[model samples]
Target: MVRSILSSSTENVLEKALGASALRHKIISNNIANVNTPEFKRSSVLFEERLAEALNETKATPARTNPRHLAGHNGGGDFNPVIVTETTTSIRADGNNVDIDAEMASLAKNNIYYNAVAKELSRYFSNLKAAINEGRR
Candidate 1:
């Protein structure tokens, strides 16, 4: 029962998003750290579109009667987003394109978004506990 609750859909989605964002954060930090390096193209994590598509995939038809049987279009499992490409958006004239201002902005936005998701997850767990306790009373 505990395992089932821990593996709930909400938890899975939140965990996947958090993992992806954390990896993106690491990549962004690396880019900032290497801003002064010559010939270094800025890398970025591209997972939004893929994540959205996976969220939309649902199996409306099932071949087997089993609950786990193939259903709604497969979400294609966990997101394995990779660094799609490097950008040459030059913010400087030295042939280097690492824009500190843009990177900071992105990092700040990502932090805020991640925090919001975490808060939501906390609230969800709290509500679940409340529901469980209410049933006992």
Candidate 2:
């Protein structure tokens, strides 16, 4: 009962996204740190595509009238960010594929994305708080 008030599926999904963003931030920072190392293939976290696919799944499920009955597939409930190493390309002579320019660009974009998601999450809780307080007045 308390879980229903504190969060919904949307909130859960946003929290997962924030977690993915934090992980992506760490991975990107690691790549940037190893920019000068030899043959250091840059790594990136892939989350959005998989998350979207999970959320967009349209598989059919049997309807149950009872609360104890079996539940259907949960969208975005099992999604996780995947870390991928770029191993096919090397621009420098040392065979290192860590591109400082591209990484920096990605960092900026990710910062904005993270901030946006955080703001939205904050807004959700703020609305909930407002509603709770309004009931007392």
Candidate 3:
């Protein structure tokens, strides 16, 4: 029962989202820190698209010919965020692509997303705790 709760898709997705957002926050902070460095390119984290793809892929039923076949793992199991560097254009004369305004906006957005995910996770745990305690009362 505990394993099932930990492996639930909702919990897994929320955990992944929280992790991705935290990583994104660090990447955005790094980009801002290197904004003045010469030839520095802004780095961004890519996870939502890949997460969506994983989720969609898991929705499909896989053919199993043998009982020993492994179950498909999706969503949080193998989800990894890709860090892509901006190389196409430079917004500054120093060849740095980091835009302070954009980075600030991204930081704000990421923070909001992180907080939302955390709140959801907290609620999930709270519900679980309540369920566990209900038998005592």
Best candidate (score: TM-score): 2
The digit string of per-residue lDDT tens for model 1 on 1-137 reads 87875567777777767777887889889888988987667888877777776666634334567887655556636566678546646666666778888889989988987788788888888988898899999
Weakest ten-residue segment in model 1 by summed lDDT: 55-64
Tens digits of per-residue lDDT, candidate 2, 1-137, equal: 89976768779888988999999999999999999999899999999988878877624445578999988765556778999999999989999999899999999999999999999999999998999999999
Pairs of residues at least 3 apart in sequence or in different chains that clash in candidate 1: 58-72, 58-73, 59-71, 59-72, 59-73, 60-72
TM-score of each: 0.78, 0.86, 0.83
Error of 3 at 11 (Å): 1.7
Off by over 4 Å in 2: 58-71
Models ranked on TM-score: 2, 3, 1
lDDT of each: 0.75, 0.88, 0.87
Shift of residue 2 alpha carbon in model 2, Å = 2.2
lDDT of 3 by residue, 1-137 (tens): 86975566788788888989999999999999998899999999999988878877777747667989986654335777889988998988989999999999999999999999999999998997898899699
Model 2 CA lDDT for position 131? 92
Distance from true location, Cα of 103 in model 3, Å: 0.5
* Global Cα RMSD, each model: 3.2, 2.4, 3.0
The superposed Cα distance between candidate 3 and the true structure at residue 123, in angstroms, equals: 0.5
Report the Cα lDDT for residue 75, model 3. Answer: 38
Index of the highest-lDDT prediction: 2
**Per-residue error (Å), model 1, residue 52:** 0.6
